[model samples]
Target: MIRIGTLNVGSMTGKSREVAEMMNTRRVDILCVQETRWRGNKAKEIGGGWKLLYSGADENSRSGVGIIVNSELKEKVVEVKRSCSRIMKVKLMLSEEVLNVISAYAPQAGCDEEEKSMFWRELDEVLTSISEEERVVLGGDLNGHIGTDRRVISRIHGGLGMGRGTKKAKAS
Candidate 1:
């Protein structure tokens, strides 16, 4: 089985020592990191044995993504997309299978009703493109409390989800 880990590091510069310490202690086969604040000139291979693949913080602090693979592992980047913010594509060479991983950090809020709907609707469309049959995995700080309620309330529990989060999770 593939062991994967995702962490919203909240700006590595804010906690660089903590981030490095955690990574050193964990034996993560594949790691997805967000809010790295990585820069074009400053980002480099860190830690002793990690084969690093990463990108910097984009304008508006939009895209900051990083992936780490065991240096002994054979791998290549399949596709990289910085198009819609921090979503990037990387493919891994497992012993017997090729795995595809997408690292994403989505937009946090919208100004109005139309904008809010449009934002999530776009996320849904993107999710539809992936095939479950492929060895594909998505990891990042989605920033949506869909899987876990922030207020600890569900619609059935008298919350204001309006069943939107539930439907999106089911469909995609």
Candidate 2:
């Protein structure tokens, strides 16, 4: 199985040096990053050993996301779509698996419910448009809580409470 990891960089000053540094230890084959805070060639030049295909964010603030894959791995960028200054998409190919990854940092606040709702609605539509033939792994910071605590979610859905504490072994 290929290795994949996601990290919330929390506003990187330049190329997300701190985030990249921490990620280096995991030796990940593919890394999905959020809150990169930069764009264009500047972002590309950061973090060696990986081909950075990314977009989003503006010149003043780096509030976007990207996909950093080990260059040694033979792959192609199928697409890179930016939803907003905060959300971006990176579609890639790995081995026999077509990996479609999205890195998102959503609106967080009691007053931003409208914004959150709209974003979710649009996202749902975007996801639905994809055919099942394509394998997808969308992940990112997602600052807003989605009703249930995410960590508690199991590989098998609707079976446990949030986190390892609430899980029970599947009956034989």
- Go through the candidates in order and give each one's C-alpha lDDT: 0.59, 0.63
lDDT of 1 by residue, 6-30 (tens): 8877665655445555666786666
Clashing residue pairs in candidate 2, if any?
A: 37-62, 152-162, 152-163
Best by lDDT: 2
Q: What does candidate 2's lDDT look like per residue over 85-147, in tens digits?
A: 656666677668776777666654433557778767766765776668887777777664333
Work out the TM-score per prediction. 0.64, 0.69
lDDT of 2: 0.63
lDDT over C-alpha atoms for residue 114 of model 2: 78
